[model samples]
Target: MPRLNETDRCRAVGMIEAGVRHTDVAIQFGVHRNTVDALCRRYQQFGTTRDRPRSGRPRITSNRQDTYIRVVHLRERLRTATLTARNIPGLRRISPRTVRNRLRERGIRPRRPAIRPVLQQRHRVARFA
Candidate 1:
């Protein structure tokens, strides 16, 4: 199951604070009792339902740059990643593969569409046969 969102987390914490039993809260939220316990503990410690800062190398592209990338690709859906990479002013230094990666993150994939002749009524009858 997916992790609970902020609303669900806050609701769970509220119920726990209202003197609801941990197991009962868990049942009501459809989560394990330990999950409820941990959420309460986190609330007590941090006093916030937001996630902690994650450790890793930061992204190469800013939100604006990513938006530019998406827009450029959307404008020319059939454009190759190599061409798209050259098109973006800020992303020109990055690899075409990186451009493709960003596009993939936004659920855009470039593929050679299937090539088939359009079917007429005779072709449809032949398929049924």
Candidate 2:
């Protein structure tokens, strides 16, 4: 499940503090009753607007400013080329499924409808006048 954003946390807190029932808060937030109860309990315990820690995929591209600059560089370098899963130095062996994800992270993508050759044999051609 996705973690709640600040807006959601604030909304939940505000609604709870406004005397809304936990079940009502859960319905309003589109979360399970237990989640609403837990958020209310957390609010009562912590008395702060800060979100609790959540477990999920760890962050990549820790330096966001540098990562954005690197993405720009990658885009400039790869713009004219057909970027397959191969050819990226550190990503040459990356899986086909993950290639797009890497490209997405780097803000680069191959041109759609990648080039393909069309061949016609002379024997297959019909005689013309």
CA error at residue 121 for candidate 1, angstroms: 33
* Candidate 1, 48-75: lDDT as tens digits: 9766788998687778877887888788
Per-residue lDDT tens digits for candidate 2, residues 10-100, read: 8988988889887887777778888777777787899866776889895332354334334544656544333443344441253444445
CA RMSD of all predictions: 6.9, 5.2
Query: Whole-model lDDT, candidate 2?
Result: 0.62
Error of 2 at 129 (Å): 3.9
Which TM-score value belongs to model 1? 0.58
Off by over 4 Å in 2: 1-4, 45-85, 90-92, 112-128
* Alpha-carbon TM-score of each model against the true structure: 0.58, 0.52
